[model samples]
Target: MTAIKPVIEGTDITSVEVGNTTLKLKQTVSLDSLQELISAVENFSKFFDLTSLGSADEGIKTEWNEQDLTQFLSKETREDQIVALKVLSDKGEVTREEFLNEMKKLLKNPGFRGWDLGGLLAGLSIRSRTWGYESPYIKEERREGNEWDTFYRIKERYAPLIKKWLKERGP
Candidate 1:
């Protein structure tokens, strides 16, 4: 990002974080008052060049791209993991049942009927023995109103990146 230095004296704007999901404005002023931050940014917004911003990781270790996807996933991988990535990247959010159905269809296995990937271990293919640290790409959350029913979601920023990559690197 092009750092917008405080040209106007007494302006305490320190940094501005631009993310795919949300734009986080960092400043020296108190965060209690959102209005002040809004006004402060409004005054100096013209000086900001948001075009060349940094990749929005959304807490992921690295940004999702074709190159990163290859390196990150090529090591010690699982078949289910790849299938899950494909499904989640396209679907965005899939409940346990929906996910299992997709898995069954993709894998072409009748045995997957009523089967479960269970915990993050299978859902994200978390291998403690490997460099993979509970995939930064996918999130597993327990669906409300059900204890066992969980849903998988590919982070919004990564969905399209994955979809594009998968398309290019076709089966």
Candidate 2:
């Protein structure tokens, strides 16, 4: 496993961790892009602790990062999001049918296990229309499959944040 540390390059560029790799990016950013970058950094700084992010539970975990998970899943919808992610984390490659069945079986909340639950399964694009939310994990494959058949799986770029979160939070 690769390890990275804080590197001060120019006045702007800050190194980011892409997996265990150190990505030192120094480039010009458009005004809009700069703003977005600042917003993202500010948002990411809220975790209070980043040291234990991907290392604490490395023995068994996916590539999904905990910060990214929290950013995508709101408290109200986190349970649903976790259920879907958990299925992918366990099965690796799966279809929407498998996802739906696993969700029905894993979702502990009675109110969220309704037939309508599948619609918000991934909060992804449906019927070829954008839903404004796409998981870094499997956004394209988990689509409602209006344009084509669906395929789902955990993203390779992410760390094993899902399994760690579930173990810590229960179910």
Candidate 3:
């Protein structure tokens, strides 16, 4: 059997080899910046399937109804909510204003015992910054203000190293 190498391994900083150049990534920084995006994309596929079920079969129309919406709201974490919102926004089902309005309505409903609306809203606002959405409630200041900023900074810092590695591998 051949030996298998780990992609990332370290205590504080992780060493990852893209092609030939090995780059050091701060474990906390990479996880903090990219974990949500990674999770959102992963869960998005499932969320799409769930939403598509309604369109796939007439019997499944009820699956996307108020109760289902309530359940989704109640169960989804902050990252999931962001993914859901992004999916909805992409589908043109709701704009940012409509999403916020719906959230407000949900917040006022006593029956909707769900995740904290404030945290969800904050997460949404922060995620929107990278896509150029302006929110009155959330302001992303500098490099450290938003997760996207952190992701960008990390990518920028590592691009040279990655490029060098890539060059070592010809087409």
Encode model 1's per-residue lDDT on 92-137: one tens digit a residue: 8888789888888889976775444554335444442244333545
Candidate that beats the other on lDDT, 1 or 3, i.e. the better one: 1
lDDT of 1 at 91: 83
Query: Model 1 compared with the native: what TM-score?
Result: 0.48
C-alpha displacement of 149 in model 3, angstroms?
22
Worst 10 residues of 2 by lDDT: 124-133
- By TM-score: ranked, best first: 1, 2, 3
Query: Please, what are the lDDT tens digits per residue for candidate 3 over residues 1-171?
Result: 111112322322233332333333333334343455334434644444322222112232121233333333344335435333433333333434344555556445433322454455556444434333322122221222221121101123323432333244222
Could you tell me the lDDT of residue 146 within candidate 1? 19
How big is the RMSD of model 2? 15.2
Per-residue alpha-carbon lDDT of candidate 2 for residues 23-135, written as tens digits (9 for 90 to 100): 33454334435557645645655653434454212433333245645544434345566677677778887776666677767775434443554566535323112323334
Sort by lDDT, best first. 1, 2, 3
Greater-lDDT candidate between 2 and 3: 2
Native-to-model Cα distance after best TM-score fit, residue 91 in candidate 3, in Å: 7.1
Candidate 3 has a TM-score of 0.18
